[model samples]
Target chain A: MDKVIIAQNLSLAYSKDETIINKANFSIDSGSFVFVTGASGSGKSTLLKSLYGALKPIEGSLVVGGVELCGISSKKLNFLRRHLGIVFQDYKLVKEWTIEKNIMLPLIINGYEKSITQSQVDSLLKHVKLQHQAGKYPLELSGGEQQRVAMARALAHNPILILADEPTGNLDDYSSQLIWNLLEGAHEQLKTTVIVVTHHIPETIKIDYKHYHIEFGDIHEVV
Target chain B: MKSFKNHISLVIALVSILFSLQVFTIVERSIDAYKENLAQNYSLVVVSQKTLQKKELLDKITTLASIEQLSPDNVIKKLNTGISKKNKELLKVTLPKFYKLQLKIYPTPLQLQRLQKELLRYPYIVKVETFSNTHDTTYKLLLLFKNVIFILSLSIVLVTILLIFKELRIWQFKHNERMSIMGLFGAPAWLRSAVLFRLAIVDALIAFGISFVIFSYFSSSAWVSEQFANIGISVIVFDKVYDSLIMLGVSMTVSVLLASFIVLGHKEEV
Candidate 1:
């Protein structure tokens, strides 16, 4: 299988003197479900940021979906990001927009036709079990329901890679299980590479997956 | 209700700007029309030793509208009867040719002085009467009025434009989160800020409509017509098509430019 992400001596930082992740090297194969676990401030989220072009590499090289993330132009970065879906812990949905519209964000950005986008949103709404609350705003929904909306949005565009940064961090048991099932479903059915940043991995996942643990600015795979 | 309240500040700013601009146009046009009225009645009388050619005189003084030689019969008739027909004929012959010089437009006191000097340059021209005392007072007052109105209108326009920009920036800040989310999704800058531009355009149209109605009512008001009549000049206070187009253009340009500035600032921050 082709490598979906390759990092060689990668370093991530927010400022000049403070390096978060230093000289880390790793690669993940296409269509693999991978979990990145680390302590708070171990740079797990920073690593995921680099994969989606939110954070640039301060040193060395990082590549995702066949595009280099280091020193990338905004236009090229946007193009790369279009092929990737990102889920945040806080569920960054436009609150003013309806949940249905929130799920339609990716498709709209991808320039999908209205008819197709609406149909896809309708099906995704049913899949996320929020079909009854299509016209409601994000704030009107519960935390779990909102995260499910965010999940449905991430999977809406059929991205090549999905990056989830503690997607189920604040959700309840049912919501967390549903999120896991959705992520697994996308990985298996769509052949999408999934990289999730979390502190723990659930024991209920029934699939072959890889695990990389970040410690002291270094990433190493666990057997 | 909330959306209507949001549009208030921008709409007010646009209205003040457009209203000031229209007032400036009206004042300028009224002054011009009044000057036209004055030019019709204003003329200079010149006594010359020799007959003057219109073309040659025009070459020297370009403002000359028309020159007509004043017949001397009236003055000759006014003379005493002690002068016989032969003497009267000789008196008329010796008298300098009287010519009235009208100008194409009303001249300022300084321009009239310059014209007097230019006319006296020719040895054949003896005396020129410009009635400067009366002309000076009226022209000075008109000029002062025009200057005052121009400064007032300009100041209003500048301050209102600043306020409009501030209001637009506030609107942009309110929508910043939405725009940033769109940007993260690979939407281009223009597409992400489309909401700001749309709001600007919509507010501009509202301002334009309000301005048009206000000016239209003011233009047709009987009091406004009476005031123009009192001044003895006809001024076009509002032109429906032309003025509307200008107001629309100005409001659209200012709102869009301010919105674009806000969008650029947000982009830089991100």
Candidate 2:
């Protein structure tokens, strides 16, 4: 299997005085589903941020899709981001835009034609079961609906990898089950590499997935 | 409707500034035309013992456009009302030579004084009367009016520019989150800022159109035309095409520059 992300002795930190992840080592193979579980403030989010070039590594090597995260230029970072999808815990959907436009954002940024972008957005709307709410703004939708819209947006451009941070953390049981099923479907059907950050991993997940736990700034694969 | 209300204050501020500027330009031109009309009718009376050539007078007073020698027939005719022919002839011979000295333009009080002193240097010249009292008062009043308009226009422009900038900054803040999300999605800087530029362009056009209509109506108004006629000078209140083009340019430039400033500031913070 090809390695999509490789981190050797990576040190993540917000500032030089405070380190979040010290000497962390991890590698994620292509087309694999993985879960990162940790307690509050255990540096799970920081490690995910470093993978997308949001947080810089204070020390050691970290690479995503052959691009180094540490000391990356803004132009190079943007280029790297084009090949990845990120789902924030708060949904991060543009409040002023309609749900359909929000789903089309990544496709537009990737320079897809208007016809293609429209069709893609329409398909994603159906996939997320929000076809009726396509014309509504993000603020008009429920938390579950908004999160599903964000997920559809993340998958709009068919990116090589998707990094979801606590996607089901704030959802109800019904929305959580729907999101988990969507992630499983994307991983199994489309063969997309997915790394989800959460405090709990559901035991009912039937697909094969690797689990990593973080504690006291140390990352270890549990199974 | 909310967006329109949000942008209305900025549009009004821009329009006020632009209208003041247009009024200032029109008033300045009108005053210039009035000054030229005054110059055409104004001249000084000079008495000289010796016959003076126009060229020699011009050499001595560079400000003098021409000198016209006045005939003594008017004085002779007045004295002849009750006198004999010989006495009238003698009165004519004794009368001093008078010449009307025309000026190229209306002179400032200081320039008039300098001209008087320069004329006094000639041994043959005796009296020079410029009617300084009336000319000085008129000139001073015109200058005071022009300065007041200029200062008022400047104040309006300065205040409105600050207001426009503040309004634009608010708009920028309102749109910053959306722009940042676009940036994270790999949108280019220009793409992220497209909405701001569009807003600027649209507002500029609206302000330009409003100002153009108002000025056009003023230019054709009876009161405006009557005011210029009263001063004995015909002035164009505004040049429709040329002046509007200039106003359009100013409106667009100010709006675009302010929008760019806000966008650049947002980028730096992000």
Candidate 3:
């Protein structure tokens, strides 16, 4: 399998003299479900940010979806981000837009036809079980429902890689299970690579997956 | 209510700026037309020691429109009636030539001085009366009026632009979150700030419409027509088609440019 993400001596920092994720080396295979576990402030979120091009590497090489992210121009990074779906912990939905419009964001940015985008949004609404709430705004939805909307949005574009930064971190047990099922289902059905960063991994997941734990600013795979 | 407030603020600023511009244009046109009227009635009296040829005078002074010889019979009649008819004839023959010089356009004070110097360069053309006292007073007053209007209009435009820019910046702040979210989704800069552009364009159109109606009404008013009649000059206060196009262009350009500034500033902050 081809590697979707490759990091050799990747170091990420918000500023100089304050390195967050130290010279970490890792490679995530295509169509694999991987969990990055770490304690609070262990640079788990920073590592995920580097993968999605939100944070650039201060020292070494970090590539995602076959594009080198270190020193990448904003224009090129934006183009690369179009093919990758990202879900944030806070559910960064445009509050003024309706749920349908929020889910349609990725498709609209990709320049998909309006008719096709509408149908895809409709289908995703049904899949996410928010079909009845398509016209409501993000604030009108509950936390779980909003996260489900975020999940639906992340999976809407059929991206090659999906990066979730604590997607289910603030959700209830049932909501967390629902999010996990979506990630697993995407990997199985669409053959998409999934990288999720969280403090704990739910043992209920039955699929074969790889685990990488972050400790002492280094990422180590756990057998 | 908040959106209405925003629209009203921008419209008010734009209307004030457009009003100042219209007033400036009207005042300028009126002054120019008045000057033309004055120039038509004004003439220079030139006394020459030798007979002055019309073609020669025109060639010497390019601004000379027409030169008509002043009949010396009237001045001669006012002289002593006891003089013999032959003496009168001799006096007329020996008298210097008198010519009225009318210019094609009104000359500025400096141009008038230059014309005087040019005319005096011919020794035979000794006495040239330009009526400098009256001409200076009228021309100076007209110039001062034009300069005052220009400075006032420029100041109003500058202040209104700053107000519009401030309003747009506030609007951008309100929409920053939405724009930032769109940015995260790989939306281009234009798409991210589409809302700002839309608001600016809509407000600009509204302002243009309001300004057009106001100017059109004022231009055709009876009072405005009477004022122009009193001044004895016909001035075009507004040209519906031409002025409308200019106003539209100016309002759109100002609003769009200010909105673009806000968008770019926000982008830099991000």
Candidate 4:
């Protein structure tokens, strides 16, 4: 009954001259795993951006975790980010910092003390099976490894919700299953609300997860 | 940890600017003090004659405003007596009867040679001369030594800043990124203004501290500090007070202006 994300008549667009998705509507329940599927330009990523406070809605309303997304200030956006975990298909890790430091970025920006940052980084690294690679830089990590590291960093501050946009879009089958297992494990163990945007729906995994396909520029749940 | 390491370069840059301004103020103040002493003690001559009618010469010399100071008439009237008085005071009197050269205009080093030409024409006048009264050669060499020290001090400072800046930029970029984001986050305009205030105060303190130490050091030296000390407490206090204050005020104002420019460049979009 509780909604983690709610959008009513949401219209997303880049400019006044062009509108991509107009009068869109969606609601995602708390602690539920869902897929956001669409053709190449059906606005799946755009929808995900709106959920995590990236793109502002042009002419409709959107609420994520009780905070309005449209026209939100950067301060509130950062505050909203504290409760959110975002995993990009292309992991946006700082090239200069070590893997551990990259994972600790959100914490550092938020001004977390030095003493607790180490122990916190250690626990998250172990959770993501990345404890050994903590000393390496982002450039040193493979694509799959970098994504996992991004996942670990996103989860570092114990965010309430996780939004993964095309998490397995560029991964091999083995790496893909491993990533799904990690996402599933975090959700089941921590009861974190997770939304995953993926192209492939592998049948081997047994879990109660909803599937939503984007068609005719509208989102519809499919069995 | 990330924020701590970030902005290392910015801090190093700030410290370098601070120290450079410090040494510059010192060297600059010393040069200015030398120039002032050269002007203040310089005398202007209306009449220089071995034999002249005293009452007639008096009418010729009193009209120049720049000639506020003249030798005690005893040097002209009781010339024999004035020489004896100076002889008893100077422990190392180089000459028994050194002509008290009257300066008709303030002579900069370049213009001082004209005194040579004029003295040559006046066959009786041995040489037109201005003498520094102190025994210490250190003050005479103050400008040269400070210039050397300025170069040496800045070389060390630049090298240190280069090393430090390299390490700091690693962390500084991220710190700056987050800070810029924080401001763009619509961190109340008032808070960003607070950062400006912090910048102004730090720059001002640096300028003030440097000027105090620099002015004190150069002023304490017996040869160069004569103007700074005697003018402050003695008869010329009013004459020199404006210059001393101007030196301090300019240093503070310029440093604060530089800091404001840096802070302005960092502000976020409206």
The residue pairs found clashing in candidate 2 are: none
lDDT of 4 by residue, A1-223 (tens): 6898888998887777776677878888888888778888888887887777667888889998888888898678767876777888887676766899878866665567987888889998887778999999988988888888888877776677888989888977766777788788777888788888777676766678888887665777787
Please, what are the lDDT tens digits per residue for candidate 3 over residues B220-260? 99999999999899988889999999999989998898788
lDDT of 3: 0.89
**Which regions in candidate 1 have their CA more than 4 angstroms from the true location?**
B69-97, B268-270
* Model 2 root-mean-square deviation: 2.6
Candidate with the greatest lDDT versus the true structure: 1
The alpha-carbon deviation from the true structure for residue B181 of candidate 2, after best TM-score superposition, in angstroms, is: 0.5
Q: List per-model TM-scores for chain B.
A: 0.91, 0.88, 0.94, 0.41
Which regions of candidate 2 deviate over 4 angstroms?
Answer: B55-66, B74-94, B118-123, B267-270
- Per-model chain A TM: 0.99, 0.98, 0.98, 0.93
Alpha-carbon deviation at B153 in model 2, angstroms:
1.6
Pairs that clash in candidate 3: none
**Cα lDDT tens digits for candidate 1, A71-179:** 9998998898788888989898998789999999999989999999999999999988999999999999999999999999999999999999999999999999999
TM-scores for all candidates?
Answer: 0.91, 0.91, 0.89, 0.59
lDDT of 4 by residue, B1-270 (tens): 644333334444444545565556555654565555645555434333343234443445432123222344444444455456566445223322333334333354445544455444644445444443331243446657777878877786678557644643443443344344334222343443454455445545554555455545644556554655563422222113554465446545544554444455453421
Q: Report the poorest 10 consecutive residues by lDDT, candidate 1 chain A.
A: A47-56
Preferred candidate (TM-score higher): 1 or 4 = 1
Model 3 residue runs over 4 Å out of place are: A139-145, A171-178, A202-208, B1-11, B80-86, B171-176, B193-203, B266-270
